[model samples]
Target: MATFPLEPVHDTFRAIATTVVPEAVALDRAGWERLEEIIAEALASRPERIHRQLRLFVRIVDWRARWRHRERFVDLDPLQRTRELERIERSRWLLLRRGLWGLRTLIFMGYYAQPAIQREIGYRARPEGWDAVRGAGR
Candidate 1:
């Protein structure tokens, strides 16, 4: 069976459009219109592709958030509190800490990385072709 990240991509693109369009509208009506046109065209042509891109973008943002939080924990010197501990005790603490870090990294990478990888696979599997036009601006 084949699976796609269409849902994730759709959500991510919607998030980005929601966040960015407001700012664009504040620029000027013409600018807003132009942005709207671009968005409309993208949505009309390859909605699924845009959605996939958005999902990847969201995953990247989420990973960055996690990394920032992890940095805060590291800055707190979480390992320093265990000084003067026995070898076995220190080993156990280290194992647990390493396990947590590994798990976090895996999750972050898995969520963000798989979409792009899958997208490439999908693209190669089913390449997009040019659309046929029935009339000239009819």
Candidate 2:
């Protein structure tokens, strides 16, 4: 059977992604699915060690929720999820903090990579530069 390696943590990543970028919560089903596919494609080009580290970090976030709140990361309320992520972002350990920031960078990349979001934000980059985009503004 064909499979996506990122499938195992997609749900956990969904919660983490939405928590990192709250606006993502408003995305429709197709948009969300595309976001996952995009993220998977991005990760696919990276080395396997980075892949393993990121997947482990995702699981750690989920387990940390249960350890601290007696609930899974996805099962937590929005407020709780935000607070949990914020705490991790401010973690004292250098590696832990780095991991959170790296994960967040990926989150932003996946979210902003959406064409709709790019249009909403008025971002249009053309190889020909400003001259090409000028007409699009009119």
Cα lDDT listed for each candidate: 0.36, 0.85
User: What digit string (tens of lDDT, one per residue) describes model 1 on residues 43-97?
Assistant: 4555576445544544553343346454321122223211211122345566434
Task: Tell me the spans in candidate 2 whose CA falls farther than 4 Å from its real position.
Answer: 1-5, 130-138
Cα lDDT of model 2 overall? 0.85
Best by lDDT: 2
In candidate 1, which residue pairs get closer than 3 Å at backbone N, Cα or C atoms, i.e. clash?
A: 9-51
Candidate of highest TM-score: 2
- Report residue 59 deviation for candidate 1 (angstroms): 3.5
Residue 89 alpha-carbon offset, candidate 2, angstroms: 0.7
Write the residue-wise lDDT of candidate 2 on 25-51 in tens digits.
899988877777777787777787888
TM per candidate comes to: 0.25, 0.85
Model 1 earns a TM-score of: 0.25
